[model samples]
Target: MSSSRSQSIQGTLPVIAALLGNGFIAVLKFVGFFISGSGAMLSEAIHSFADTANQALLMVGIRRSKKKATNEFSYGYGKERFLWALISACGIFFVGAGATIYQGINALIRPQHADVTYIVFTILAISFVIESGTLIVAYRELRKTGGKAKFKKILKNGDPATIAVLYEDGIAVLGVVVAFVSILLTELTGAYYWDAIGSIVIGLMLGVMAIILINKNRALLLGKAIPEEVKDRIIEILEEDPAIESVTDFRSAIMDVGKYRIKCEVEFNGNALAKEMFARGALREEFEEVRNDYQEFIKFCVDYIDRVPRLVGNHIDKIEKRIQEEYPEVVHIDIELN
Candidate 1:
């Protein structure tokens, strides 16, 4: 299969896995909640449901992002994933965090003894194992893209769909732990508020992550620039070429997860470019033969002048090609002569 198609499929793997895992865990949690009337278990159920929906939305975003480019959207549909990720973030805030917190508060107001017994433990254990398994899948997928770099750096530049799943799965694992502790406390002290507290904590965790995802997606949608140090490296590459004097007025923006475009004004080293493209020994010999004949010399000068622009154009193409080779993510490059 083609690389892009393979990449697109790879992008969805974590989301798809999370979706299935959460869907199953949601069912398990609901069953546990019904039997034991545990608010924490109910909250986890709701969280899983929200995650399932959010993963589905991410899948939509990934699919739509693969849409072919058009005149109306010249940069292609890469940002489509960011738009969907923002929507998913809002879902986490409202549907996930909102409902979870509201449930916790409602449970707190009317606390009740819950007989989770040992069955709830079994359910939570299963759920925890599944959630952890999904989280591992996400981590492995991220490591594939991120290599040996720190996870923070990877997430800083990772795909939004995959990153969102990673965050959600992490929260899921933590939520299970909190639920386990709250249920244990409930069994120990005969106080139900601990269960409510666990729910609230889980909700707060989701809220924090949701807000972060929202802000992150918003920035990416607005075409956030790549890191300055990376941009500096790109600039350095351009100026290192002898035909180019310096690069200025540089600008860049991410077009997608791992793709971006750059624009800059370039100052050419005129004498160096002239010598590289035009000052050939064969040309010098030809010029010497034509110097004594007025018509021939005039023709030579005219032909030389005519070829200059084409040669310059070719050189510019070469420079641009080299820049792309150095930074493949620079899918588009615009250079203005200064």
Candidate 2:
């Protein structure tokens, strides 16, 4: 679109690195948590585990969304991408934020001094670097599709999977920063509650990220309409045809992430159709054959009128083909007489 629009931009980058990085970081975070018994480290571990789960869920969606259309699902399984995204949000809410917050509260109730300072710090340093690397990769891939596109554009029009990768990596990086600060504070101040507070803060961040992801995915899963600019472009394409005088009852909705179904009623110009037939010399030959007899002319006129629907249908097919040439995302088109 020339401007703002809500449509999924489909791609398959930024997933592998984020998935693998999260998986590796999750193991290290758990190791640090068990060794140090710091609430912040434990929270980071849970966050990383949730991220690992997110990768698995995203992979599930990517695979399932590729399934061929079935009788029961005539539109195919494209929405399944958003389906697992929704599920990942739910997982983040419960497993990531919920567990982290609970652990924070538990640590607050029963505070414990952390141990193995150097090892815990080393783990956090590595986690931060890994998460940041994943974030950078995700951003680079985003630029490939977005290319100076603002965050608003990506949020409104990006593929859910890519969005998940970028957003999750971002939150992961922030979570690691919070974890590092909290642990460092605990080490300097000897107050275990600082670690607990860090845990709670990380949980809050995940909660917010989860909510945003849930809402975005829900809109997509429910077949959100394409942007107004997109609709106007299609309409303009239709009206550009001389045979189409006007358009009415235009409607479009997502069939898959990037694909759409468009339906509309078009007012065809009878004179234009006749002119087209004249240009083809089909009507001139018929008129020449019937000019001698009034009865034969009436029969010919009746036959010509009877085939008007087929004539209009042929022109519509051509228009549809042109539309496909102009906008390939328009996979399904339904043009009706107005």
lDDT of each: 0.88, 0.84
What are the models' TM-scores? 0.94, 0.92
- Candidate 1 residue-wise lDDT, 1-338, digit = tens: 65455555656889989999999999989999999999999999999999999999999999898887899998899899999999999999999999999989988999977887788999999998998998888888889977788999888888888889999999999999999999999889999899999999999999999999999999999989986777999889889888788886899898876678889998987788867646564477886889889999888888888887787788888888987777666788887788
Q: Which one wins on TM-score?
A: 1
lDDT of 1 at 270: 74
Off by over 4 Å in 2: 1-11
After superposition, which runs of candidate 1 have C-alpha atoms over 4 Å from their true positions? 1-6, 285-289, 295-304
Q: Taking the tens digit of each residue's C-alpha lDDT, what string does model 2 give over 1-338? A: 62112333243546778889989998999999889988899899999999889878987887788787899988788888889989998999999999999999998999988874799989988998998998887777666666576867756776777778888889988998899899999999998899999999999999999999999989887778876778898899999988889997798887665677899998988888788777878777777888899999998878878788888888899999988887777878999986
Q: What clash pairs does model 2 have?
A: none
How many clashing pairs in candidate 1? Answer: 0
